[model samples]
Target chain A: MFSQRKFYTPYTSPTDPCPPIEVKSYETPPQLYLGFQPPCLPQYASAKEALHRGTLWPALYSPYESPYKRGDTGE
Target chain B: MWYYEKKLQYPVRVRECNPRLAKFLIEQYGGADGELAAALRYLNQRYSIPDKVIGLLTDIGTEEFAHLEMIATMVYKLTKDATPEQMKEAGLGAHYVNHDNALFYENASGTPWTASYIQAKGDPIADIYEDIAAEEKARATYQWIINMSDDPELNDGLKYLREREVVHSQRFREAAEILKEERGKKVFF
Candidate 1:
């Protein structure tokens, strides 16, 4: 049996990115190599948007235009 | 055109004797549900099977020939240079005392070979299912032999035979699946 389909949000255009971000500093802890680091916070909106556009991080996109034809078209 | 080839799949170089194990392996040759029976069963049944199942039956039947050779080697080695005292120690005194180093064509229990082990009914589905059950039974016999053996060399041979049963079972199952699928697609309307 088929299940209900779920919709995902699309990604935003990378060229339109412009925002001010904050940086936090902390003292180095002992046994830094063995100790675990804080889990990464999720960016819900951006991730949802990227899913919709079929463009996610670590994935590249090609932006170009071509107008060419090949072979016979049953003419 | 003629060709003569002399090559053994398993070269037997050991001279030690283990008549008990040898007697047990003889089942593959002359026992009910033995390799000889299995080979003859599949080969003869091929005629009744659909064209699609012919290759599968042939391949399995050919492998049964290899199993027959393995069993023959085991019997030959077990009986070669077997001393009366050694036979007594291995609990094969009765066979050695009666057969006198000659390999009688018999099962592990010294039962004579019978043709009833093989059948070639003109029904492909029934025959394929029978082949599957036969392979499983052979595998079980191998397991029993392995459990009873202490010699590592003899155990290794039994292990190989056991693994082969698994492969043959799988192939027969695949053949059955193909038959079922083909029948399902038939247009009777």
Candidate 2:
């Protein structure tokens, strides 16, 4: 499975006052991987789950976890 | 004619009062790429759009209004019991002076919303592209909001709103494809 999250490193100056973040992460929406939505794609087992996730199709669901949280980036 | 639904499309829950977060949430409420701009843009553009995609416009545009209501509920809950000092510290002093605790159509910086935020060229390709871009922008805004928010319950609602943007963008892309396929086809009675 392709990751919806993407990452990058920014140039850090040695003289900078604050510590530079080694890696910065951003998200890519699922639609970028899809050209057009196909018919009869697999759906969530329950409509309530779909409503909670904000998407009925599992393929289109891209979860966003806050990068600020410890270990949220899977580091 | 549209029928009024008494409930929000999605339930909004605010775990606590945080005027600062409310200030940030106002961006989606009335910012350039906010829900209000999105709703009006599609609703107005539908009249000039092609027959096949007009219903899509109507549906998504109407949904944006529901999203707007959700945001309004959040803002109301966040600021309802907040003191003026808290509002000032939250960078909403200007807003407090003008609207008090009532919600106003303004961005986080208190800039009032304007129609200039949206455009309709009357071209199906052009307009649909705009809609897709708008959804992506709103999605990004929601993500940033989640990043700034400390309220887990609020993040739940924000996440849902952000995901809706993804779905809406895909639907618009599919609409574009449908329009493209009809480019040179002729219908005979």
Candidate 3:
């Protein structure tokens, strides 16, 4: 299975003014994993849940977690 | 032809007054890859696109309008009771001077939206590619907006919009392949 969130390390300078950002991360959309949507793909159980999730199909759903909250940022 | 919806596609709840946050949100509300641009671009291109993908464009284009309304509601609630000082501090001084808390079709930087931000290339492949890129860019903008905002309630709506971008992008990609498979195929007029 492909990971939705990805991380990488950035180069740091000896005399850098700000604290070095050791790790940086970003999200990959679900479409990157699936070549093309197929018919009869599994869907959310209820329309209300699908509406809240913003997609009817769970395979296509990709949740975004803020890097700031994830501690992936220098802040 | 469209029917009016009295409610927003997603609920927009702004629990606190934050003019500064509202200022940042104006980017999506009127920015190049914002909901309005997305809506206009897809709807305008639908007429010239292939019949197979026309309904996709129509449905997504219509949904973009609903997203636009949600952004408008969030901005409204965020700045409804903001003081002049708060507006100034929020970096909306020029906006207040001109629109006085009214929503303008301009970006966060105060540059008004222009048709140059979008394209209606008659080529179906080119247009569909543009639509896919637009979805990705909108998704990125939503992420940045979510980063800037700290209000959980507001983030809920932003997250929904961002997820919708992913869904739309997937649909557009599927449409592109659907168009691709039509290569060398003919339709009787």
Chain A structural similarity (TM-score) per candidate? Answer: 0.19, 0.86, 0.86
Q: How badly does each model clash, as a count of residue pairs?
A: 6, 0, 0
Error of 1 at B140 (Å): 0.7
> What DockQ, on C-alphas, does every prediction get?
0.01, 0.75, 0.79
TM-score of candidate 2 to 2 decimals: 0.94
Winning model by DockQ = 3
Comparing candidate 1 with candidate 2, which one achieves the higher TM-score?
2
Q: How much lDDT does each candidate structure score?
A: 0.65, 0.91, 0.90
lDDT of 1 by residue, B37-151 (tens): 8988998899888899998888888778877877777788877887888777766788777787777667877777778877777888899989988987887677667666666
Instruction: Mark the regions of model 2 whose C-alpha exceeds 4 Å error after superposition.
Output: A70-75, B186-189
Please, what are the lDDT tens digits per residue for candidate 3 over residues B9-125? Answer: 999999799989988898888989999999999999999998999999999999999999999999999998998889999999999999899998888898999899999989999
Q: How well is candidate 2 docked (DockQ)?
A: 0.75
Mind giving the per-residue lDDT tens digits that candidate 2 earns over A1-75? 578887888889999799878788888888877877888999999999999998899999988867887354434
**Clashing pairs in model 3?**
none
**lDDT string, candidate 3, A1-75, tens digits:** 577878788888999999877888877889877778888999999999998899999998888877878665432
Screening candidate 2 with a backbone cut-off below 3 angstroms (N, C-alpha, C), the clashing residue pairs are none
Chain B in candidate 1 has what TM-score? 0.86
Worst 10 residues of 1 chain B by lDDT: B1-10
